[model samples]
Target: MSILNHRTVVLDPQFKDLEEFMLSIPALFTENKGVVIHKGRNELRRIEYKGVEYVVKAFHRPNIINRFVYGVFRPSKAKRSYHYANIYREIGVGTPTPVGYMNIRKGLLFDRSYYVTLTSTCPYRYEDLFTHDFPYAEEVLRAIGRTTAVLHEHGYAHKDYGRANILFQQLEDGSIKLEIVDLNRMAVGPIDMKAGCKNFERLPATPEMHRLMAEEYAKARGFDAQKCFELMQAYRSVQPGKIDGLY
Candidate 1:
């Protein structure tokens, strides 16, 4: 691979050797390709490196205009994912630990970028709860609501705060632990009540379910449950599609 200009950040000492392999991403991607976790604008491939599992996300190629724009104006998606993963860790939010990120440039313009993170197998995603009447559904939803409230209170606004992005694992103590993924589409800023409610817009849960979550969020934020539920309903009414880079 011809790396005209490349940058990578390794957060964990255990994964320091992952940096050397960034140069051979093409070969590693081809040799260790596993099941596809997600496939849309970007692709998430589960791969193993020296017996340690990791998820490598390949971002879509940019257009002519975006090549320059991303190369000059903004950090690539890989960099953003790496940046937010550390920030989430710093803010006491749970996410997959970032292994590293790489940007391959062709001359001055950016060619491709990739993000690597440790793979985690949570028992359930919020999306499963929406589709099935799982046991402890209300409790799980409430916990997620409280967790999201804490994130918003700390100024962590997840642009793609949909069901699939939130993962939960049930513990032996009958409590659930939550972790977030697909973290590149996130923002950090002051989040008001309305903005907080809007964050749940993409969750396709029923109105009653949303109300249940609103109660928990209201409790955390000291807001009215009815008002929060109403705002979430209004935001959900628009029903925007999944976030994409072109937007």
Candidate 2:
């Protein structure tokens, strides 16, 4: 989508008075955060003026290579962050609507990189839910699996798939909606079977857990049990390493 695609966006200019736009790339934190919700090396926070919340990403040492590799395919990581904003909108996927992003240059005032998403209430990570008791927990897991397959069928892969990155937004009347939190690494093209499998490989849980997630996905996407297993198996067979990488 075009930069102006959104209804109204307070992009880089919101910080123009405090800082000029540049790609120091790491200083995005100071520019994006008007009020700090919490801070750490991997994730940062900002309270949106509209009373929403957003988690800002700040680059660290370990991810430098991954960020650089992704840049080869995308002009900016911030740009790729919006890839899902379009992807989800087009395909009915559930995720936070990407608000905007900024990449600041090093040596520039408070240089860094960051992107923002319209925040929901205190989001619960998927894995954390398993530690407690909840109804339809199994069904929700399956929903994620089926939802993921739908993404693959449409020609995309969330290379970073795991319970932690997925969040739950509790609704009124005691219901829930799921959202994919991180997107800087999501990519286009044939699903990287290896990367896709890697997503589930970390899910060391009961066979029932795996079964439930896959079942929910198959049911939601109308794949049935057999096809879902085939897809999961196909993904698992791929080696856990770089495939084509991402944008």
Candidate 3:
């Protein structure tokens, strides 16, 4: 049998016992019997541990060539997700609370990895709000705009700031809270006004919605509204493609 190497980091003290369960990530992923949240490049599952629900994202095993490349050149996605979640929290940005992460390797080759986070009850995403009529839609859109602007002000760029990755929760106090997900592609660096405006390239917003977002974003960042809107438009025009029927 090939030697397996495993390492884990648990962020929650209450979930200390979960650390021991990290050893079973490989088996849990292989069993393939959980509420599948996502099933693309990586697989996400909602699992219950002692009645507490959590989401476990299992990244695809690398190919032969990728095994060597990942082992030598970079940290696993699980590691990046864990660290980024912490960074977002530190910056006052919202994301699902990270529970832990695990990296599995066979001999010297990178094999599989998993990222676990607490399950949240955010049933609405920016996608839903954009595509359907909802109460206080304008307020929510402006809030999203402000949130994105604040994210940029903090020098964080979400590589995939698509609507689906931005989740929303309506609190009992009648306020909305937004959380960003799919964080492995995020980066932290100094962001200029133009670059920050370009970050909206993937959002599916109508021209009127774009105008509102641009106004709010510019106001928050103290940029010229027209200039910011133009910059957003320029970047959006060059997007690989748009999601049809979303605007």
Q: Residue-wise lDDT of candidate 3 within 1-247, one digit each (tens)? A: 3456645455567667887667676677678756888899888899876788888988898899888777778888888888888888888888999888887777778888888899977888888975677877787778878988888898888888887898887788988788888888775777777778778888877777788888999999998989888877777778534222221
Clash-forming residue pairs, model 3: none
Q: Give the TM-score of candidate 1.
A: 0.89
Candidate 3, residue 178: how far the Cα is off, in Å: 0.4
All candidates in order of lDDT, best leading: 1, 3, 2
- In candidate 1, the residue pairs with backbone N, CA or C atoms under 3 Å apart (3 or more residues apart, or in different chains) clash, namely none
Global lDDT scores for all candidate models: 0.81, 0.56, 0.80
In terms of lDDT, the poorest run of 10 residues in model 1 is 238-247
lDDT of 3 at 179: 85
lDDT of 2 by residue, 42-149 (tens): 565555443444555554433555444433333455556665666776887787766566643322122234666657554577887668776757656766776677
RMSD of 2: 7.0
Name the regions of candidate 1 deviating beyond 4 angstroms. Answer: 1-11, 30-32, 241-247
lDDT of 1: 0.81
The backbone clash count of each candidate, in order, is 0, 19, 0
